[model samples]
Target: MAPPFAGGEEDEEARWCGLSTDMMEMILKHLPIADHISVSIACKSWRLATSDIILPALRAPWLLGSPMASTSLSWGFYTSSNGGQSLGLEIPTEFQRQWCCGSSKGWLMHLREPRNHSQYYEAHLLNPITGATVELPPFPPTVIKGVISTSPFATDFMLAALCFESTNFDKYVIVYQPRHPRRKKILIDNAMDIMFHHGRLYILTDLAELLVGVFDPRWKVSFKSIPTLFEEEGRHPDTYWGKLVESNDGVFVVYCTITTGAERQQLKVFKIKEWGRHHRIVEVKSLGDRTFFVGPFSDGVSISKMKSSSKLNIIKPDHIYYITGSEYSLWAHCMQKRHTFRVEEFKMTGNILEWFIPKLEDRSNLMVVTPTHSTSLLLTIIIVMLAVIGQCLLGWLSI
Candidate 1:
């Protein structure tokens, strides 16, 4: 009976399954990382091909047109991975003169200039991912204190917040501001600017008060002011734009105080752990006119310190770029080293620099400052123990 249909016959049957390698590749492309790993172990062919697949391309789509699209105002480009020079996409001429903020899902928010000083401001929302561009609704009419800033840093959501006072209360409310720049000009005041933390939104006002707002997906915004730690100093001398940064855990409140007849900018990082609120403040050299905390938090939680010197911004966690400034040099506090990128710094120039560093964007690639082999072994043991407890739940589910 043809040797009981064994060996060659079985091979023929497997071949008749008609699974083309090309079809397998296509199927594996859409699977999540965990599923991909699971599938590779099913057979030898998939194991070889899946191991060779490039992972980053599987990430969500983003804008990669031009970093220098604006003729009127220069723009900077940033991503979690090392952004290739070829990936830079230029903004269309229509968006050249206007202020634009780009979100994680490739949403571009631009403010169209008004015809007259008193004319209403116009804004548009363009999703580069879906290529859906539409005008936004008008925001609450208040004199928005400052311009909108967009962070390339990846978070749960791309956010925008504004700070304003209600005429009734001397206190200001930081609104969960949307990415509507034109509405900002019409409805919002200059006291507001966008700030994000641990996927939360905050309104940072000119008074140095941070009003954190929590909102639902329905666009119903609510405001809660983060009371200052300053001990009754009568409204702690106006904190500036460059002073606020979100750390690995919470937010770092930075402000320059005149102590003992010298200007000292105290970098105080606030972390909320199981033990409650904790503060870590350090006296560092040359607090950039503006610096963004980008990682390698001393703990398992990583934190990045991004500081600006001139047009060149030293974004910590690697992938440095000259986004805005006349000079390419930066006084990096982490490395405690000065770096210059030559003429590239002039590509985008300014001091009123405001932009977002997408949170944990390039986190994995960051050079973590870790301890020696002995300490690493200890950490590994702790991690393994934690993993055991975590996997136990999965094992129980299978039963």
Candidate 2:
């Protein structure tokens, strides 16, 4: 195809360079961080536009390639940015073989059974980019799901997992901090799904009952119960799926219940609101600008905060991509089009296919600025300048 605008090469160049700074910045917002960084070096105006904009959390997650793919044994090496395409990844060979159970805040749960304890599995918090591994505490082998508060690269972050305790199948949620010697345990018999939102852990119980767990600075937690969303069906579990999804508005508890009939499975979504003593959940009519994806395990992601150029364009908004009925039985609930259909291409039957997202920014460029380092560095620079000035004065006086 030929170019749409017809002009001399010089004239076309001038037209692009003439765009105002605000307009240039607006255009750059639709591009990925790396792509915009590349555009910055093109000219002065483009550089000025991109310099001040804060780098955001790229929302579209990378779908781990099918375990059966032929690429590098495809264990964890290959990735599909969009559902249809494949890309080669340089993940470490050790990580390539581990079972990827869950992902949160751009970190994957890499678990391996070395000694094979009936209760726990040996695991490492993997940094795929550098292949740097942090030895993590023993994690439950039978985990329902887990999440990390922030990048483990930071000094303080928490890993929370909900799993059965032992052979009797007692439900327990364990919280692990990096430097802490012991893990904190919360025994909630009927808890369905858990989410860490706004510094508080929200535990979803039977029939959409909300339990908010408030954590202290020391990691001690206290629970506050919120009112139920709807009338109770019975003591039996009504929530087939309950996940805390981030929307454009805020973090919301999205719970789904399946219809009792056998012909086709129907799913309902509900959003929670806070009231004086009793928080409330309203049935969600549509997903506003959020694509919620849930796999067979306990991981669900709201893919909303993304750039257009980011390969995550494969995930569409107002849609829910989930595996129900069976592992291979994948369905997409498209609310905008009011349509639901089976997604056949994504069907993976044999090996586990968990959604993996590592932070895109190079770690060396990232910094955590606290009073501890910044203040000391400032003092050191001042001291060096003062010493140089003193030495110069002495030399001049001696001369």
lDDT of 2 by residue, 310-343 (tens): 3344456787776555344446777766566666
Question: Which candidate tops TM-score?
Answer: 2
The 10-residue segment of model 2 with minimum total lDDT is: 365-374
Global lDDT scores for all candidate models: 0.37, 0.59
Instruction: Kindly list the per-residue Cα lDDT of model 1 for residues 1-399, writing each as its tens digit.
Output: 121123674553343233345544555544433344233443444344455554442231111222343355644332222222222423455765656533322245566656555444565655332224555543323323222223333233333423234564232322324432322211323343444555555544555555554556555555655545454454565443323444444555433332331113223333222223332333334333333322110001123443332233324432122222232122222213323232322322222222222222222222222112124332442344345546667899999
Query: Model 2 off-target regions past 4 Å?
Result: 1-59, 65-74, 77-81, 115-119, 130-132, 232-239, 259-263, 275-278, 297-299, 305-314, 325-329, 336-339, 345-351, 362-399
TM-score of each: 0.43, 0.67
Model 1 has an lDDT value of: 0.37
Q: lDDT score, residue 125, model 2?
A: 70
